[model samples]
Target: MQGDYQVISTLLPLENPDHLEARGIHVVRTDVTKDVSVKELKDFLQKFTGGRLDILINNAGICYTMPATDTEIPNVEKMFAVNVFGPMRVVRFLHLMLIEAKGVVVNIGSIGGICPFVYGSSYNASKAALHHYGNTLRVEMRPFGVRVVNVISGEVSTNILKSDHGRSLPQGKWSSTADPAPMGHTDTRAESVFYPLNEEFQKHVHRTPNAITPNQYAEGVVKEIVKRAPAAWFWFGASSTSIRMVDVFLPRTTWDWLFGRMFNLRKLADGLPSQIKL
Candidate 1:
């Protein structure tokens, strides 16, 4: 089965909806945060496929990188509305279609939730909330023969950096490693800048040697989604293994210290701006 891209209306520009239709891919804009929008999507789908759907993928998500010190309450609220509640709304609204076909429900999550990162508390927390929702929904939906799959992704080249972020991380500020350097290693690259540590975590992330491209990540994820007996959880792309490895091997306090040093949390927490718009 071909992968379908679900665009969230508020963030995506659907200047020409017909553009995608011409290519045999229908683009139905749905905003999971709004009940009205979700209802409208359900109505449209009922007509389009006669109230039957083989798969429902709740993949709408947003990310913001900022220290919790400067993360505005409104920003965190927005992230939760989309990343967590969004899935709940979509799955609830599409239950009829899903149950009709005994379809699969896919929730895209992040390793940030599984293994919290520095300077991205809001985004990480939002993902964690969604991850939990998937677990609960898996059991609830099982009665209807609907499978719920949680996709915990690693770093990938995606438009989220530009759409969700205000400023791009300077190409190479404090260089990380190409070969899995442990905590406390220091390296530098071109266009590197330090201070005002709000963007420190992001800078550290993008400067990494490599990340799986979105195309490759999508291919693997789609394959998993179509399995006869799909696994309840999945991990894909770069840094996914690293975080899992740390979680398995390190103690709670040790993991915290490692993230603190690797991300310069203390140094940046004291330097937070009054407010930063993510």
Candidate 2:
């Protein structure tokens, strides 16, 4: 049996503790966004592993649903701080150990990194930057026998929906009108129009149903790591495959048209009800 494998994250659910422990993984709590916390992690790694490090997975992330216009600069900075710079910090601090072991560094990016979407500017940009960073590092680290793998995931059933980290557009900002639906009555027209748009968006972006569990994602990660020569990139979950295909074959204008038709963005923008200023 392999000895303890050190894993660090901001939070680990108790329900999944046994899943990791079963694999002889020791969970270390650290804030990747903080320099002090990262240094502390380095110190802990030195003390615990005695200069031996194997696999490093940078999976900690947060998401929000805010329009680009409404997204504040500070929020963008915060997202980059956590999603982009955080992983770099870990890789930089642990480079020597990983080089010694010829270890792999796996960054958990998102499908949004490949396919940009509405109301996800900050989150998408951060992941996109991380993707590029990983790609560049892959070439640079080759001499040291360090493999940099970027994993792009589509929507899985996660706590991102509940989190307040991503951009948050105000009510009716993205909608056509505040009172598009009549009081006490549902708007079937809007639903009918938006459903296909949402589906088309999912087709391009690869949003997953509730079926793809995070445990399954974690298991896939383990499998990817075990490959004798792992892939430069891996996409897990249902949408992952489709999104990759689209990314390769589809043109930028085609994607833009698809997104525009699906979201009714132009319609929403033109049809927005006027606000009365006091």
Candidate 3:
């Protein structure tokens, strides 16, 4: 059967729709946070695909590297709006289409969900929620022959943390990894408790130089999607295997201790007020 591929992204530029359209992908402008945007996407798909959707990939996400204690509720809510509720909204609206086609729903999750990296508490929590949601979705959709796959993604080179985001990547520009985008919002709020640790946070948010290319990540994800019985959780992208091993073998205390020194949290804790000492 011929595949109908489409992408719904809030960030894709309308000025160059043909960039993806030339590859036969029908692009739809969608903001997953809003019900109206997702509903519009569903409506368009219903008409375009004859009320059947063979694959639904929830790939839109955002991240902030602020410490948990320093993170504003609005920022936390914003991440959840895109990272957690976005997939939930899409699945709710298009589940019937998925059931009709007995298709797959892939949630592009992050290894950050499993690994508690310092300064990424909100992003981690959001991804963890998505991962759990996808797990439960798999169980509920089984009888309908719909498979839900959660991709525990590792660091892939992307400009998600860059300031000038939403600019399309020029075609044929990918190498083993993309050029590093300058880290955006690398400083902590001056009045926050973690303000003194701004340098540590800056180091943490710096994109990994060893990250895989987007194309390499996509190739693995697509292979899992086309499987007759895809695994419930597929781990791919750079450092994914290593993170999986760490999650499986490391204890919580070990994790804390290792990360503490890695991000200078242990040093920071030593200088905190006596009353707050652990």
Candidate 4:
């Protein structure tokens, strides 16, 4: 998009646009939760491209650290609105334009969606639903020659850390996604998150290794989009393959066992806790 194509990006209204505009990317203010946003995007694309679109990327997402037991219902709703509904709106409204250009729809999902987590039900559930939706879209849009590629991303070194639990968030416009709730000071402290399960996982995340940078992840995604025939599911980033294998071959309790060993949750329960198995 930097040199070859004109990139029109959407961000929250409060997000700064000057820097992105400086990079020659047209920035559109959009709140995916709103019904009008889809119409606005359609109009913009129509006026910009004469009703032909090459690619549609649904990248607007938000994550918060909390267990289902302690999470407020509205907060979960907000996560769904961003992660699931926002992308759904864009794809639904823009499908025609994509068909016109034989385009591709790229959805950025998470390994968290596939691999079970004791403490991430809200965020995890939203992503899992999204993964399923992308699969469904792929089958539905096949005849139209519109490719739906679900990028099941591993944890990348992105502002997601700050968005999930606001520690060390960079000042100015560093992230496309808005911080969900000022980070809630997410940290290794037991009080960092509400549920004990999530608190331990949050602590472990602080020390977890092998996360790739956002640029590397972006490079992989670009490579996928340019493929003549892209895979319906593509994965990359350090530790992603391991997690995907665990999700596919291991029982649900094994992932819980992992959570226990990583965060010392097992010590409190003698062995790997059975109660947290999903």
Q: Rank the candidates by lDDT, best first.
A: 3, 4, 1, 2
Q: In terms of lDDT, which candidate is strongest?
A: 3
Off by over 4 Å in 1: 1-23, 164-209, 266-278
lDDT of 3 by residue, 37-152 (tens): 88988898889888998888998888876677545566678889989999999899999999999999999999899998877788899999999999999999999999999999
Give TM per candidate. Answer: 0.77, 0.77, 0.83, 0.81
Span of ten consecutive residues with least summed lDDT in model 4: 167-176
Across 155-184, the per-residue lDDT of candidate 2 in tens digits comes to 677766655532122333334333334433
Q: Which predicted model would earn the best TM-score?
A: 3
Whichever of 1 and 2 has more lDDT, that candidate is: 1
Each prediction's RMSD to truth: 9.9, 7.5, 9.5, 8.3
TM-score of 3: 0.83
CA lDDT of each prediction against the hidden true structure: 0.72, 0.71, 0.77, 0.76
Q: Over the stretch 40-90, how does candidate 4's per-residue lDDT look in tens digits?
A: 978988999899988888999988665553455676888899999999988
Off by over 4 Å in 4: 1-3, 166-209, 270-278
The local lDDT score (0 to 100) that residue 124 gets in candidate 2 is 88
